[model samples]
Target: MPKQLIIRGVPDAIARDGWWLASDATLPQHEPPSPTFPILGEAMKRRMPWIASVVFLVALGDLLFWGYVPGVSLVIFAWAIFAVACASRPPKRRVIAPALLLVLASLPMVEHAQLLSFGFLTAGLLVSVAWLRIAPSRGVEVLGAAALRLSASLPVAGVKGVLNCARAVSHERANGALPAWFSAGYLMRNWAFPIGGSLVLTVLLVNANPVFERAIVQAFQIDIDLFSLMRRVLLWVGLGLLVWPFLIVQAPKAAMVVTPPKTGIKLGLNAGSVLRALVMFNLFLAVQSAMDVSILFGGASLPDGMSHASYAHRGAYPLLITAMLAGAFALAARPFLAEHRALKPLVLLWLAQNVLLTGSAAMRLELYIDVYGLTYLRIYALIWMGLVALGLIMVAWQVLRECSARWLLIRSAIWGAGALYVCAFINFAGLIAADILTRATDPTVETQTDWHYLCSLGPAASKSIAQGTWPKLQIATPFWATNCLNPQPVAMNWREWDFRTGRINGYLAVDAKMRAVRDEDPVGR
Candidate 1:
């Protein structure tokens, strides 16, 4: 007898002869075990389930792993999953935007009580199957058809968008048209390939233990994790990519009916003002630097040195939030008051401030040139204070654009975060490079292109980090970058110097803990 399931209040044949009702499910007798989509009853029965399983597994694993949770949620999750499977015989769940959103929103809380995951899993499965109407991406022609479907449903949208998508896809396939996400001409055509690959990459990341930790932190904003930040950025970028094609392909048609960008700022003239604005920015930095000094010495005014989720805390932060208020109020209240030009002097003041801040760090670095051995200090505390101050000052003149934009998830935060990410990545790379170059012994370094390379199931990499002598080929290095975050680069840098000078053995990024492992000989000598 065929395996059966009650998909819709009735018994249905699920799989047979090694065939699955869906791709992932297979008959016990089939050459390979097959899986069931559980949403599609009959349509899925006739097709080979390989692709369905692949897509289903991505969504299902997340579902099962997340556990059972339901509400309006289960229905939505099931719909998304079904929509993906039906997109093709081995159809994918990549296009189920709603289910994707549900997964994102459904993560367990900080304490890790996963009742929420269970709710999400069930809700996710049900909800994923509900979006049968959006229609999957085909060629531009199909996309254009989908556009018409979307427009007919919208009072604001017209048929022009549908026509434009059709034309663009045709022109691009023939003469090569460019999509907006591209910095140059014709960068992306098929969103499916990238989106599909991104899902795969995300799964690999999900398996990595540290990557999981980072994902948890980003969802909760509980702590600083480099891989977590990197994952969030990539996830957003991928989401942006998925959204961009759909939006841009519809742009020309959409532009015909929509309001244009605001004209108050004036793009060309605004370019020149950017320099002056930057000067004011430096002044803002100065105020913050001075504020930090006064707070640290004048008396504890606020949480100046530690991280804060917001400005409510009454800490004399490295940033001077109050100082920028005067300039901001004037800029906003009266743009033409012509009274605001004095903001220039503050620009010079901020430049002076950063000079002091950088000098202070440099001075300390010099003190520890070889052996001062300083403890941890938040290096970018000053940089952030300065940038926030500058953006705040620029907001005063009506020239700062989005400096005062509302704080919205994945929007306002993403901008500041993108900048911070660059800073963090550069900081990490620089420190890691320095550690490896100067270390007393060679360490295991995983330079797998991007940071996400480490987010996967694998044998431990750090077990072999920082052992053996220079001029020797074999050594162990740290598996996860987190392990080396504190003791790295400086320790690594010094040891390598020792090795090159014939004072010790090898070159791998090592920490203070590896001091004894710096040499090749059994003796300490």
Candidate 2:
């Protein structure tokens, strides 16, 4: 007779005549084995064809386009997902938005490719998974949830699953694996004869004719660096891991919305004290506002030996920081002052004044740009001021309407992302070149144009440099000859052919023709 022992939360062992009997079944079981146990191997076996196809597509893209334009990699990644979606059972229609967005994101590769490509790619991937797996009605909330899960799920399950799948394939190969239509041996068998025959014939022809051999060798000279190939392969594998989880793992069905419980406690500060503080703060801001109006707008004489440009330069960045601080104070103070009736109106007035202060900061930057000439930094500063103004407005709306904090943060983040994405596609360097050239030519503008700075603006400014007549500007003969006259040929494949670079090349050709005509003439050319 077997002893029926109830050992809760302990190992299944029993004493019998001073000896313990043990078997594999004697081990304590925390939970029953899942029917779908060994999910990684099973899933990989089922999806191996699609997975291999995706990896091949990524590798092909790396070979063809990755060196030329980084953004092209994102497009290839999106296409991989699209291909996988097409293969999925009962295919997901919802992935279209994110896939299309990712494709649209690739257009910047030809114009203004930059570091933001990776971030844009990440967001697109998250959205792809969220849209297909989560409810559509969740809207932007899905982005936040997807972002949260991304960090936890991506590195943990993805790398492990891939390694396990590799192990499974190895194990299967060792144990007489079942042959599939898409198996490696099948593909090799089908392609071997044609590929081998073509190679043999090509080699024979190459040996027969020197011209043919040279032409063939030169035409197909794949300048592939072994180290670069390895680096790109590793990067593709990492990207593959990122994408694999999205296809297999389920996204959060609903966002975890945490509503803070009402504390029933008002702000810690007394109404009178807070009101008094605001009154003093407003008075201080009023004095600064008055000074700005008089000095910046009214064009009053400087108090000492300070030039107008000097005053403008000194105030530009500092005043921007001051305005930012004022804005931050208002945002931080709004919740505390919600119960105070008189303070809310005062807060609104304070915010409005801060907006005016931001405008003054912008004017200061513009003044500095006029004196020192336009630069990438000045352009970005102006744009930043505009965003700050927008942010202040959003803060006011949030406070007054009692909007959800999460909602406000998500919206603001989205706005910032959209702005960055848009900025990435814009040819700001061209605009700067145009502005600088225009300023240089204007009779009223006496400031000497920074030709050195213009040259430093990269290929986008090449056309402007080419268009300028050097003799009138009294630019250095050596500098003019080296920079504007002689343009170096930019070697690029089709993928790296940017709009600005293409235009620059056209200008260079025209400039070369002009130089030739001048050389042909005897009129002091």
Worst 10 residues of 1 by lDDT: 495-504
Best by TM-score: 2
Top candidate, metric lDDT = 2
Tens digit of lDDT per residue, candidate 2, span 97-214? Answer: 7657656655665454456655665666565555555545656565657656754687766677778777777766554453443358877888889999999998999999999999
Q: Which 10-residue span in candidate 2 carries the lowest summed lDDT?
A: 11-20
Per-residue lDDT for 274-343 in model 1, tens only? Answer: 4465566666666756764564447546556643212212232322444444344333333322345654
Per-residue lDDT, model 1, residue 504, is: 17
Residue pairs clashing, model 2? none
Error (Å) of candidate 2 at residue 430 is: 2.1
Question: Which regions in candidate 1 have their CA more than 4 angstroms from the true location?
Answer: 1-55, 58-319, 324-332, 335-377, 396-415, 427-525
